[model samples]
Target: MAAEQAPSSNDVRTWERIDFHAHLLPDFYQRALTETGEAGPDGMSAAPGWNVQDALSMMDRTGIRFAVLSLSSPGVHFGDDAAARRLARRINEFGAALVTEQPDRFAMLATLPLPDVDGAVAELEYALDVLHLDGVAIETNARGLYPGDDAMRPVFEALEARSALLFLHPTSPPNHGSVSFGRPRPILEFPLETTRAVIDLVLAGTLRRSPRVRVLVPHGGGALAVLADRVATLAPAQMDLGDVDVIAELGALYYDVAGMPVPRQLPALLQLASKDRLLYGSDWPFTPIPIIEAMAAAIGSTDLLTDADREHIGWRNAVTLLPRLAALAH
Candidate 1:
């Protein structure tokens, strides 16, 4: 196969995109999920299937120059600490192999066994130092504990120490049974879950303390653009924020335009987050390929963004955050 030619300035559809929110559901990881009775996670009927060829084809069709793959929601931890540790190693190794095989087309974020701080820290070390994966991807909440919880401090500290790029994907909130109303959790609860995690991180001063860890929030920050002011005004009165500016903290983070971010979500996000921090994301395999194509088209044609802004979102901003992409390109 011939390498794709670089797009000319006028070629809107052929913009080389770097997808920051793509997922990989390997058979081994799926088997782990199934054994734990999470075959249908967060109310979905079954986990989406994935393979390298199909992913490569989709990337070629959609003009994606590179993708950062991750393990999606319900993560590796399923109650037992030892099982979670083993599963995390398996997942990271799988991703590292993929990246090694196709360094130009793919990069991977390592998975960690969260809620078990010791295991998570150890895995983080091995993943970064040994496997040499790009960074870490963590669920919004791990076994009912949000990222800001005191127990997760060590994990955050380790990530900060390494100056890691952290990708935040929302999982089913701990109280899904009562709030989800029996619907698939991704439809309604996922966005709210992302919002909840961000608020918790800000309120608990986690973001303030972990200044070096570059964080990417998925789904255009999950209703954060609309709700940020409300949280800013109301949270200080209720919680001891200790001089943390809610809006500032929210604005400082990076965000990906995955899962229908244009028209409403992108504009809302722009009001809060800087344009330079925005990146493209396909949320593929889980989101069907047809929808991914349509969303890419929408991003290309949307009048909301200038050509420069579109180029930035497509890949420039991502290269800034993940310098490995730039290094690989050379």
Candidate 2:
């Protein structure tokens, strides 16, 4: 895997790179976190301050032509069902305005108030039908309840009915304190939680049933491909997977090259995901700017991907996943 010269800003300007896993931090959302006393939710530090211009500048510097935004971990839901519903609407509205302001450079996924099924279903309908947002972004677990829980079936059904895209982000796992050892959960637990949520969806038949609801898994499917074979071999006998082909099901979902995907995670991810299912992501504000730049450079320079594969992951695949992007292209 020889390295190629990183593309310069001029060179990058000519290409279309669509970031599918970027985030936004609206002022109202920050205030909600503080008011809820969840400023340090999941054991991480305070939320990073973000502004539209700064986000645009980062996209330009990294050669990203467009970014699909979502509200990140410890999502809009705090504890109160009503509060969660209100915050979800506020975040969605804020994101929709950004897209309206710059349709070519920005798109947004709607936030939902999960763990409150009826509210979530209503919000999903409004976000997709009324707001005309690209898709929905949801936490892997909503306050310790995984999306695959039977209680979430209606939400998945609603998404399928709309053929909506689902962006799955990870938050701290249930009872993470028991395993976290006082460290921030993102370091290790985030990936593990993503893996767990995906498997649960498969075992619960959520993925099988909701074929139209396209799911985008973050961080190269979060150690999922690495453990896929293990689950495929043992899950049926030990658990009640009931004929689910773990590898095939995993391969069907889209995955983003966020976090540290290059050198190691990407290879493992390819074992389960086809090249067309790969997408680029720069989990900005959460992953600092310098790291995002370095990761973008590495993706451009990595020899493991052919020029064709690079093109697909950079933007082609994203366009296929969200057709609205092609319409928005300049």
Each candidate: what lDDT?
0.90, 0.89
Q: Give the number of the best model, judged by lDDT.
A: 1
Backbone clashes for every candidate come to 0, 0
Which regions of candidate 2 deviate over 4 angstroms? Answer: 1-15, 328-330
lDDT of 1 by residue, 163-268 (tens): 9999999999887999999999999899999999999899988999999999999989998999999999999898887898999999999999998986778888
Q: Write the per-residue lDDT of candidate 2 for residues 1-330, one digit (tens) a residue.
A: 899978563244445689999999987888888998888867987788888999999898877889999999899777799989999999999999999999989999999999899999999999999999999999999987899999999999999999999999999998888999999998999999999999999888999999999999999988898899998998888987667898899999999999988898888887888999999999987988889877877777777887778888989999999897787444
Against the true structure, what is every candidate's RMSD? 3.3, 3.5
Model 1 local distance difference test score = 0.90
* Local distance difference test, candidate 2: 0.89
Give model 2's TM-score versus the native structure: 0.95
Error of 2 at 59 (Å): 0.6
Model 2 RMSD in Å is: 3.5
